[model samples]
Target: MSIRGYLQILRPVNALVAGIAVLLGVLVAGGEVTPVLFLLVVAVFCITGAGNAVNDYYDREIDAINRPDRPIPSGAVSIRGAAVYSAVLFLFGIACAAFVHPFCFGIACLNSLLLVAYAARLKGVPLAGNIVVSYLAGSIFLFGGAAAGTDGLLLNLPLAGIVFLPMTAREILKDAEDIEGDREGGARTLPMVTGVLTSCRIAAVLAAGAVLLSLLPVVPWWGWWYLGMIALADLVILYAVASAFRCTTSACVRESGATSMLKTGMFAALGVLLFWALIG
Candidate 1:
């Protein structure tokens, strides 16, 4: 594959977001910023990139209709080549995690399998696919906490929920946005079954749930700084929810204003968590 193909397969921006999630996990669990944390971040990044590539491999046909510019659909990378690259990345990620901690290794292995399963089959199975994606998003925090070799999973719980709920919402919105290609490809997504308006309402509900959850006690050592930061994050989430409600057509959802806002909120939340952990 060409270097451009490799970069496209990696989805560098998403991988970086996932790597930062691992770092936040360490900070939340009060783990020392050792070289081990760096290893964990790299492992997560590789694994996430692998997942993205494999997903593209499986969704090549659908992408041809929905996203012709994607690596596989555009012929930038062959399906077999992408599959091999994904396998190599997965193994390398597992190896890195194994060197970090036994718990991290176990999570990495399971996550890799789940990623493959999602790409191969679950992605077309309606709500099941969306939930699986949500779980994968939440697992980043758990994987990070595991790398710390501590029992402070509680520290990671709220962060996991924060990531999970909004991701679930986004997954549904994406399904709604891709309804045309998905239907053409015989996908049984929620929007296909219940229609776009209903799916949008469901997504909005999930977004609201995330915002409400954010208001409760999350970080044990958090102070006013954390509260203020999180409140601002909540507003961003709320705005996303509002935008979801405003989306009157599939085309609007495809524009993904709400999804972008959610991503921004997630990154802002992580920054706040890191700062709070340091100052506290």
Candidate 2:
């Protein structure tokens, strides 16, 4: 397979974003930007890449119908090759984490297993899959804290909740988008079981909750800058919330605009954290 195919299998953009999240967590938890922090970022990135590869591997058939252009379904990569790549990346990621510290290594190991389980089985379950994926997203912050050698790691919980709510909403929207393929593939997703309208409502509520949780960080640690940045992020979230409410058709939810809006909001919130770390 071509190198480009391998990169595509890893979903490099998402992996890069995951790495950034790790760094933001480190910064927010007052972790010094040392070699160990760098190692943790690399570890998180590798496992995220592995997760992406394995997700494609397990969803190859579903992707063939829903996303025929994906690397695995489009003849760019073989199943066995993708599996091997995933295993190697996972091992490397875990090795990096082990070198950092016991706590980080433990988290890395657990996250890796959870990623595998999410891709291999949990994705087929309604709501459970959404929560698992959200937890994975939120855990990146915790992983960052552990890497930084912080005793106040629990401080990351508020931010984790902030991340979790929006991500859960986005995953639910994604499920709604992929309902047709999921149904054909025998995947029991929220939209497939509860119907798209109900799923949309649930996602909207979750988005709203995320908006509220975004303010929890404005304490002695964060100030006006955080509030201003989060307010901007909230505007985007509001737009996404409106979209979810207005979505009467599955096609509307399936379009990239719907989920893209939510992603933008989440990343914008992340940018706020990075900004706070730098100047606040």
Candidate 3:
């Protein structure tokens, strides 16, 4: 159970999903694939692992209070061990990114910095923490394109803003549900500022906007596959958002998180095929 829990801490599933989006973005941006993808994946893994370790470090107090079963506070892994691991991962991530491209290396630095900030300080701020995390979560895709020497092929600023901003809003909503754990741990997020219901409504609005934004890249530059995937993703996201709104309960929101994550994963999974086809 400890091994499994620690593996969950690694969040490999999320890393793989994020990697998919990155590869798709790279392909769409017309980057010639030559082992660059592998390097990018390694970089993602390291940075994400480091981020996990740092979060554990900063959240030690919170975990003791709210998540007593976690690795560090629960005696599964020593805090020193976790810190050393995090430092190693971060170093490895930087090295991997250095082999990719300067742009990607810079992005890795930013990601690590933001993760540390979120873990140490930003988490208590209203909405700020959620935005930081959401951007970090979605940035893997953007970095993939950047690594391939594509400035903004598949994931332009507009595209990223559209997808990530809404995701940030949703993250805030999640904080609201985790208020018990968060409040106990002394984190003051958006829901703490406004209210749970208000946060939920804000998430709904963002979800709707994300669905709409998925359609923007479907013009003459793109084709049927992109269109189809966008439609499919929009349908799935809209349904999940609607359910979250209608249900309006903590249990319901938790379920919606799973549903939304699944749908988001689907969207990322299908991106490669769509963008590969759209490459001019």
Count of steric clashes across candidates, in order = 0, 0, 0
TM-score of 3: 0.85
> CA shift at 1, candidate 3, in angstroms?
11
Predicted structure 1, TM vs. truth: 0.94
Per-residue alpha-carbon lDDT of candidate 1 for residues 1-280, written as tens digits (9 for 90 to 100): 4789989889999898898778778778878779867888899999999999999998999999999999998889999999999999999999999998999999899999999999998988889999988998888988888866657456788888988998898898888888889888877898888888888889888988987777677666656666778889878877776787766567988675877887787677667766676676
Task: Give a tens-digit lDDT track for model 3, residues 201-249.
Answer: 7877887777666666643355676767667666766665666665445
Error of 2 at 155 (Å): 1.6
Runs in model 3 lying further than 4 Å from the true structure: 1-6, 64-69, 148-150, 153-155, 218-221, 246-252, 255-280
Candidates 2 and 3, the one with greater lDDT: 2
Indicate the residue-level lDDT of 246 in model 2.
62
The all-Cα superposition gives candidate 1 an RMSD in Å to the true structure of 1.6
- lDDT (Cα, 0-100) at 83 in candidate 1: 94
The TM-scores, one per candidate, come to 0.94, 0.96, 0.85
lDDT of 1 at 86: 98
